[model samples]
Target: MHGWLTTPPGPGPHPVVLIIHGGPFAQVTVAVSDETQVLVDAGYAVLACNPRGSAGYGQAHGRVIRRRLGTVDRSDVLDFLAGALADAPKLDAGRLGLMGGSYGGFLAAWLTAHDQRFTAAIVERAFLDPETFLGTSDVGDFFVEEYLGPSRALRNAQSPQELVDRVSTPTLLIHSEQDLRCPLSQAERYYFALKRGGVAAELAIFPGEDHELSRGGTPRHRLQRLELILDWWDRYLPVRPAPHART
Candidate 1:
């Protein structure tokens, strides 16, 4: 596991936001982005990483999680976060948040259910139910076959919907109504299950937007999305003001 960590200036112990990259085979570089800067500026430490099954780490590492969607990748992320917290004493492990889109969004939901350490989560364009997703998504069959193989039971077991009842972390779901890749129904089903399970969850839908909502949506909507994320984190894992400013 490889990652980049950025801390806010003059911080003693800061809340941490773990940003997971989208593709199950993609890599997260050390580059800084406006989105990450926003969190850093607001006094949150941001940690972005490339876990196992991510590209740029050779073919063996990238293919290690094949046919095992939620198992190895999930453990890799958890281990990476734990190691990061251990290395950085200024990071507050108790006030942890997770943010990601697409495949990463799926992991966010998976982690929220399997782990109790995360205080909040921002899930964008997530794939919640493998059964439903196989029918609705444009790339459903290919995605399922490529990553999960042909086992129906295995797919259901790995889907986020199956574990929604265990999620207690406050979650904010951002989905694009016109998204054909993952589809909006993914978000709807997850939100419904979360509500039914008594979990703190909210869903935000962007009209006329697709899977590219975060990367190439209208400028106004992108800004709105960032604001929504910030608001969610503030509501759940708020960054306390500096001592000098408090007085």
Candidate 2:
């Protein structure tokens, strides 16, 4: 896996936030990320990695996770974080949080359900249930079968909603009302299951937005998204002050 880590200017340990990019086949480049900047400004060490299924790494790397959504990609992400933490002692592994959108959101939900290490998670505009996603998403007809394979059992096995019974991490689900690519029900059903299972969960549906809300929505909604995201992280995995700071 290839990635980047950005941290606030300091020589002390800092809370870490793992960010997973949307496309299972997309890559995370070294560039100015407004979101990461905000989180860093709020005193976080942000880790963004391009795992096994990401592009710009070659064809084999991209195809390695085909019909294998949660396995290799999951390993790559965890391993990347592990390596990051090991190499950078200044990143506090104990105060870890995760957030992702689209396919990245699927992995975020999948990881929180399987791993108990993260303090909390933000699942935004996720592709959670493969079965339902087939019928609802704009590209579901071929995308589901192409990626998950043409098997009902396989889809369920890889579905976060179906396996949400195992999730314990506090989660915040965010989705747009007009996201045809992922759709709103993706977040709704997962939120419902999280609640029924007694996990700390919250769902926020944007009134007039779509899958691109974070990138292209009106400035007002985008700012609102940033605020809510920081709020969730602050409540769940707050950044501790530098030791010498005065109140």
Candidate 3:
């Protein structure tokens, strides 16, 4: 699960964010961190992971991803991030963020449930429910079978809806209104459930948009989405000034 780490300006005690790369096989590392400049500029240490199942390493690593989404991959995310807290000295361990798009979004939401260490989370176009996703998703119909196996129950177990109750972290879900890959309704379901459970959550749905909101959406809207994520983290994971002021 080793990925890459980007250094930020200034010294110790800066907020840290784990940027998970999506795609059952794609790899986005520290070298691929242009989208994270805003987080770095806002004084946050960014840890980008390619994880166990990400591509570009070899077929051996990438092939294990089939039918192993939440089981092994999720563990890699939580455990690797928890380990990074000890290694990255400049990072403020107490103030943390989890962010990504699509499969990365699923990792963010899954981390919200599996790990309590993250102070805040930003999930974009997340495949919230793999069961429903398989049924409703336009693109998922073709890819879900490959990654999740032929079992619907496996997809259910991989879904955030199956585990959303375990999440209490403040989560911000960003998605497109017309995303056929994951569907905006998936985000809606988690948003409503998180609110119902009294867990802090919000969903930002961009109208007339699709799955590639990250690359194809209006520039202004994407900027707004980025700002919203930073603001969410600041509100929940702000750094403590001193030992006594930390309360």
Which candidate achieves the best TM-score against the true structure? Answer: 2
- The local distance difference test score of model 2 is 0.93
**Residue by residue across 1-247, what tens digits does model 1's lDDT show?**
6888999997559999998888888888866588899999999999988888899989999898887878888888888899999989999988899989999999999999898888889999998888888888999988987787788988877888988999998899999999999999999999999889888889999999999988899999999999999999988888983357553
Report the C-alpha lDDT of model 3 over 92-142, residue by residue, as the tens digit.
777778888888888788778887887788889988887777779987677
Point to the candidate with the largest lDDT. Answer: 2
TM-score of 3: 0.91
TM-score of 1: 0.95
Lowest lDDT block of 10, candidate 2: 238-247
Error of 2 at 219 (Å): 0.1
- Residue pairs in candidate 3 whose N, alpha carbon or C atoms collide under 3 angstroms: none
Q: How many backbone clashes are present in model 3?
A: 0
Instruction: Enumerate clash totals for all models, in the order shown.
Output: 0, 0, 0
Give the Cα error of residue 238 in candidate 1, in Å: 0.4
Stretches of model 1 off by over 4 angstroms after superposition: 241-247
lDDT (Cα, 0-100) at 95 in candidate 3: 75
